[model samples]
Target: MRLAFNNFISIYQGLSREIWVLSVVSLINRIGAMVIPFLSIYLADAKGFTLAEIGWVMSSFGVGSLIGSWLGGKLTDKFGFYPIIIFSLFTSGIGLILLKELDTFYEICGGFFLVTLFTDILRPPIFVAIRQYSSEKNRTKSITLIRLAINLGFSAGPATGGLLIATWGYTSLFWVDGVSCILALLIFVLAIQPKKKIVEENDDSLEENKKSQSPYRDFPYLLFILSMVFFGVIFMQYFSTVPLFYKEVHELNEAVIGLLLSSNGFVIFLLEMPLIHWVEKQKKYSTMQIMMSSIVLVLLSYILLIVGHDLWVLFIGMMLLTLGEMLMFPLSNAEAMSRASGKYQGDYMALYTIAFSISHLVGHNLGMQSVNIFGYNYTWTFMIAGLLLCIVLLQLFQFSKKREELSQTAK
Candidate 1:
């Protein structure tokens, strides 16, 4: 136990103060992130929307996210990350607060789109910030640290949000979520001093320019992004269809569902860093290899659901899914950062963020519709198939990357 504690401490030793502050800001913002997890349920239970209508509403949120990601990337590159971050936090907060007032389906759709537009704008800039703030040696660990904070908040948020919904009503979730975003904005502005400009090393600039002359032109990177979209589509069901599955198939209530969701966050909070640390220490697995393995775990997770109906089966499935998430996300972030040109970091990160945005636009709607039309078993089977396709894409990417590396070495 003493040795285990020391190892845990060691992984966190060298991250920057800025990284820590960013993690805190993420934690604050995400702690209030109660609404999105339960949005489908809220729409159905509160507004009397059918599954199809809820899918459309969620799709609208995705549409906003897709546009916001593109806009945020462009804006971050032009104006820098600081102002964009501030704008996103403030505007998204206000949007969330105002969101509670809308009643009609169209109004809620429009409102959610606008709010998510601003909310998602926060992603690219934050990735840029993480790149700027961290050293290469500790970059992945830094990303993990930020994820740790987010997961920690998720651990608390859903559980609390469930209680709030049970006792006070769904409207309370919006107020809390909006207030948290603003509070995170305050903390960020006060704690993080503006970053000073650094003169780029010639090698760094040359390498960045070579790799990212144009992200649009990079075939391999684009392929990698496609794989990420698949991953996101499969992974995001936990937030969308999985809850409804619990409620509909298992007859679980709001509080119980929240606790189950929170379990993902709690498991990640406790185990992800150590797992990451161990993986990094091995120094043998490439990023793509790790991602492929993670996808397999996620695939297995869905398979468990297809095979069983008990509460224990659900818990085990959640555990497998959470483990896959822990392995996939931080490494994916690092891979994206590595591919980004220092000169156009925002643009690159934005593209990366957009992959998930695309998933959001497609994943939630697809998951819900699949569940509604085909039922849970078919839906889970479809997700498993998606994961299999993702693995193939990753393998292709690995081969392409290896060929490129060998060619570069020969030169």
Candidate 2:
């Protein structure tokens, strides 16, 4: 037990003070992430919207997210991290408040779009800050710590949202979620030091800068983005399609659905850090190798849900899904960071954020349509097959990289 405890402690040994502060910020923000989790259920159960309507409303969030991520990346590069993070949080809070009063289809869609835009705009800047604040050695661990805080907050959010929804109705979620963002902004202001804006560039230097920072210029990184989109679409189903499935098929209430959602967080909190530490100790797998294997677990998770109708199967699937997330997310983040230097970290990470945001844009709308038109089994099967294709791509990427290295050596 002592040995195991020490091993666990080792995972956190060298992360910077700033990283912990950022993690705290993330924790606060995510704790109030009640609205998105329950949005579909609210629209369906409370407002009597059809599945197609719910899907489109959710996709509006993704559309906003897509624009926000792109703009936030460019803005963060031109300005710095602090202002963007602060503004994103504060405005997102206001957006959430505004969302509560929006009941009609168009009204809610527009409101939700603004809410998601402001919220997601923060992602790239936070990642840029993470890279700035951490050492290369602890980069992956830093991302994991932030995600750990997120999952910890996620564990609390749904559990609390469930109770609030049960007792107070859906609007309570918006209020709490809004308050959480404001709280996170306050914590961030107090904890972190001000970062100076990047030095202004001359016209020639600006042109050079644009060329260097453009994500389109990097082929391999673009390939990485493609893989992430697939992974994200599959993973994000937990938010969109999965909850609706539980509620519709099983006739579970908000509280139970929340518990089921919280299970993902519980699994991550208990096992992710310790497992990552152990894997690092083994030193047998590359980041890509770990991530690729993790995708397979994601496939298995969907398979479990498709094959089994028992509640226990839901728990089992969530465990597998969370485990895959634990492996893939942090490693993939580290991989993204590895591809960039300090000069264009914001742009690179922004591109990375786009993949995640776009997945939601595509996933929610597409997954919902699939579930509504086809059955749940068909949706899961399609996702499973998509993951399989991702695995093959990852393998091919690794193989090509190896061949390129050999060719360089021969020269």
Candidate 3:
């Protein structure tokens, strides 16, 4: 127990200022920004819309998120991080307020698109900017804290939103979320100043003033983006498809569904850091490799849900799924940050976020349609198989083909 306590203490000591600020921002964003804007409940309870209409509304959010993620990266590059972050938070607050007043479907859709756009737009900039304060030596720990903070916020935020909706109604949730976002903006405005690149004694003079290149011109960043698509599909399902699965098949009550969702956070808070050390310990057990393996496992949760329809079993399955997700967040983040060019860190991270956002926006319904049209079993089987195939490809694909081509030419 003492040894374990000491290990955790040392880990905490290693955390950088950037990671700390990110965690605080993430905590506020999750808790405050989601307090209102209940898509399904509002559509059903307030508007008397059908399940299909709600799906469309949710899709609007996805569409907005995809565009926002791409734009956030570019905006960060053009305007710099602090300005873009502040501007997006303010813009998103307006979008939330629009949700409070808008009633008609078209108007609501417009608000949804804008709100989704600005809300998700803030994410990649937050992620990329954190890298300025960290190096390769500590990047994994930095990402781990960021993920933990996000989950921490989610753990508290939705419950608060639920309570606000219960007592005051849906609009209250929006106000709280918006206010929370503003609070994060204030904190960021006060504390974080951008780092300076001061010249060092041993640094090369020729390289000092060299023109900065964007990650779009960097091939390795692009390659990592391609690898992320498979992983994104697995992550997108939780927000997009899993709810329908639980409703249609598991027949879980609202409380159980809440537990299942929160369990994802619980798993990460409990397991991810411990597992981080194990993954880092072996040369072959890279953070990326572990993340790839975990994503395949996450896909398998759908399989068990489809096969058995048992609540306890599904809960256990999701624990495993969360375990997989826990791996991806830190591992892939570290991998991407390492690969980015210094001049284009914001743009690169934003582009990376775009891949995740597009997968959610474009692919969420596609995957959900599987469970809706085909039986649950078929859907789970197909998605899980696809994820496993991705894991295999990620492991074998990175550098082998390029080296093989060169060797063939030499022969």
Candidate 4:
């Protein structure tokens, strides 16, 4: 146990102080990420909306996210990450606080859209910041550390949000979430100053050549992005429709549901860094192979739900899903970062984030509507089919990347 603990501690040794500070900021911000997880439930219980209606409102959040991510990426490239990150944090906090005031269906939709717009604008800049702060060798580990912090906060947030909902009601969640964002903003501003300019190690000609190539023109990367869209769609079901399944099918309550969801975060927090470190040390499996295996785990997770209705099934399924998440996210992030070139890092990261935004736009509505119309088992089956497709895409991307590498070698 001591040996294992020391090994675990070793993975964190080389990360820069700025990366740690960013992780801390993410922790603070995500700790208040209480609203979105329970938003569907709140809509159903408090607003008396139909599942279909709730899906639409949730999709509005996706729409806003899509726009915000695109805008943020462009703005980050033009204005730099510092100003964009600060602006997003401050505006998003105010939006979240104001979100609690809306009661009507349309009002709620617009509110969610506006709030998520500002919130998601934070993604590309943050990704760029991570790249700037980390060395290539430690980049994936750094990303995992940040994810660990986010998951830790998520674990605390939902568990606390559940209690808050039980006592003070859902309104309390919004206030807490909003306040946390502002607090995170203050911490970020006080701790980290802006860099004057990004310094790249690539020669001018190579850098210029890379800067001229748009991500949209990269076929293999596009396939990878599409796979992420499918992955996001599959993973996002847990946030939107899965809770409803627990409530209606398993007959679980708000607090219990919160605990179950929080368990994903907790599991990731405990295991991700070590697991990532171990994975990095292994030369036997390629990153794509690891990602494919992770997808299989997620696929099996849904299959478990299809086969069993027991509470234990939920826990086991969550464990599988969390394991898959731990494997998939950091590696995928590294892949995206690797693809990014000089002057276009924001563009690359934006497209990567946009995949999830598209998933948000499409996934929640699809999950909820499928559940409303076809029932939970069918929804799970549908998601399994989607994962299968995603796996195929990843394989194709891997093949294409290998072919490209071989061609370059021959040259």
Best by lDDT: 4
Least accurate 10 contiguous residues by lDDT in model 2: 198-207
lDDT of 2 by residue, 260-350 (tens): 8877777788888777766666667777888988998889889988887888888888888888889999888888866654456678888
Per-residue alpha-carbon lDDT of candidate 4 for residues 25-90, written as tens digits (9 for 90 to 100):
999898888897798899999999998899788778778989999988888888888999999999
- Sort by lDDT, top down from the best: 4, 1, 2, 3
**What are the per-residue Cα lDDT tens digits for candidate 3 across 1-411?**
999899866665676776798789888888785633366887889888888877777788778988888888877766667788898888887667667888877887778888888988887677766666665666787778778888788777767877888899887877887888888888888888865551222223222321265667655456667667766876677765776778766677878887788778787887787777556666966565576677767876766766755778888778777887777778877777655544565777877787787677666767867867886678667777768766665666556435544654565
lDDT-best of 3 and 4: 4
Global lDDT for candidate 2? 0.83
Better of 1 and 3 by TM-score: 1
Residue 411 Cα positional deviation in candidate 2, in Å, after optimal superposition: 10
List residue ranges in candidate 3 displaced over 4 A. Answer: 1-3, 35-37, 50-52, 198-220, 238-252, 299-312, 400-411
TM-scores of the models, in the order given:
0.87, 0.83, 0.86, 0.87
Q: CA lDDT, every prediction? A: 0.87, 0.83, 0.73, 0.89
Each candidate's clash count = 0, 0, 4, 0
TM-score of 2: 0.83
Q: Compute the lDDT of residue 247 as modeled in candidate 1.
A: 94
Worst 10 residues of 3 by lDDT: 198-207
lDDT tens readout by residue for model 1, 201-233: 346433654545666776677888899999998
